[model samples]
Target: MVELRRDPVVERWITIPRERAASIEGLFPGKQEVSRGACPFCPTAMHEREIYSIKDDQGRWSVLVVPDLRPILEMEGTLERRAKGIYDGMSGVGAHEIVIETREHNQSWATMAADQLGLVLRAYRDRSSQLRGDKRFRAIFMAKNYGGMASRFSHPHSHVLALPIVPRTLVEEVQGSEDYFQYKERCVWCDVKEQELAKSERTVALTDRFLVHTPYASRYPFELNVMPFRHVADFASSTDEEIADLGGCLRTTFEIVKNRLHDPSYSMIIHSVPLRNASEHSYHWHIEIRPQLTSLAGFEWGTGFFTNPIPPEVAAQHLRG
Candidate 1:
């Protein structure tokens, strides 16, 4: 069984699943192809085990969710917390599923239609909400890696991981937001959004319900964040209309980035309040897009500070143009 081990100093939980190492070699053997090659995600090559799927009016799947063939954390296991000589650990009992964005292998997030992307987002929300019912899971993370360097597979897909313990980064984010609220009595993200809108400097695009902007303190060049105009802590609680607006906002944001950067590789991550937490008014959910342009050096690894060459203001101006 997979185990979640904690770093005593950092207070971070790490999943140690030795079983996945054997399947890693066979996961992505070569270039994935829709018609000519052996790509498991392709409709023709897809496995029969589908967890859930969203179908079009024509009765064809637009978005689908399936169990990961080689999951980092297994779904069926008891989350038994134990200690070993002052070290705390628990069984890695969580859900790992893949969100197949499209039936066509060539269809990508940047190129897909806004409506199609909305369906994909809906699938994410549905899966996350469903998985939250399991009392064993504490947090769910949704992430998509969109390049050869960042992704293990070439298929247009995202991963949803239901973790037994909240990640340290997310824990810090929640704490920081909570602390800020205690002092200011306002949501920090809401204030940031209002300030960005008022300045009209770092703002990329804005929909009726969403705002896309390059954060003032972006760690990477062209790092964009998509936030809701109205503060919402849980992404799964987003209404249909809000999700549709978000789809349009994301589509426009990606279009501008891809056109300017020549299809740069990036990673998109959804940040939401933990499932175990009460409805938090201080925390606002957002999607962060970090383009992988430069390599991380030793200095960056040693120090948590990132040395960005391009400023967010300049990046925003370029994206707007």
Candidate 2:
């Protein structure tokens, strides 16, 4: 049966196609061969200066944070808002940093040690907290693009962007959340966690502090959402214990995907509160993992809707097994 699902926190619809024709190999292509070239992310071949790093027992860097080699936005400029004929724009003033996830170039979240992943997650928290100090930045985005086609480089790294304005998608999400809170008087994500837990149909796994589940309106096959049980608005404020548990939770989730889908290319995004403002009561921080199983056809772009061959319930069942 074909189904159309609307996202709870966003006014977006996802259509589940009638035919489940995408096979495992079709969804996850074969692993690409790596080049034996000079990787700048490697410690010995590094060209950029480090902003922050965590050391291992041997005094070697475990996780490193460096400025993006080619930044999308400039870091030194102040926000300059401008208006043209019936249009508005701003200067490209923002901070873009690379969180070099692991010292080892070949390691990934699925393969890396749990403690090492914790260090990586901690680096994200530290960098976000540091960037929040800059009054010029209104929002911070944290994400990881993994596998050959998804990432620019083969190195295990993620990105952090501190923007002068909140992104449109995030703005909509916060607004939707606030509207829900105004009516229901509770956080939407908290309610989702509770409902998903109660149903267990879309839940893949659960830790003491986090829930790993496929959203009811998942846009892609094997899409995953990892949310903390605690209603925290900013990921930067995550406690040590919470981060540690989250590390294990993420590691297990990615490993499951890796094993089930043959290490597909995927993008992972962390959604949190804007830097300048607060949404503690209405919003909650969460992580979204979208495996690049299928490309967006013209229909999706033209209609602003996504088509998924696998229903989230079926995807969750496959993932759980």
- Return the TM-score for each candidate structure: 0.93, 0.88
- Give the TM-score comparing model 1 with the true structure, all chains together: 0.93
lDDT of 2 by residue, 1-321 (tens): 222334445544333433443355544545444455788788887546889999888998888898986676668766666556544556667788998888788888999998899999999999999999999898888989998768768889999988777766888889999999999999999999999999999999899999999999988888899999999899999999999999999989999999998899999999999876757789899999999999889999898798899999999999888
Q: How many steric clashes between backbone atoms does each model show? A: 0, 0
* RMSD of each candidate relative to the true structure: 2.9, 9.2
lDDT per residue, candidate 1, 1-321, as tens digits?
A: 688899988879998874544445445747442234577787877567889999989998888899998788999978899899889999889999999898888867778899988998999899989998999988888899887768767778999999989999889899999999999999999999889889989999999998899999998999999998888898998999998888888888888888988888899999999987963888999999998988887888899789999999999999998
- lDDT of model 2 at position 196: 97
Best by lDDT: 1
Stretches > 4 Å off in candidate 1: 19-36
Candidate 2 — which residues are off by over 4 angstroms?
1-36
Among all windows of 10 consecutive residues in model 1, the one with the lowest summed lDDT is 29-38
Model 1's number of clashes is 0
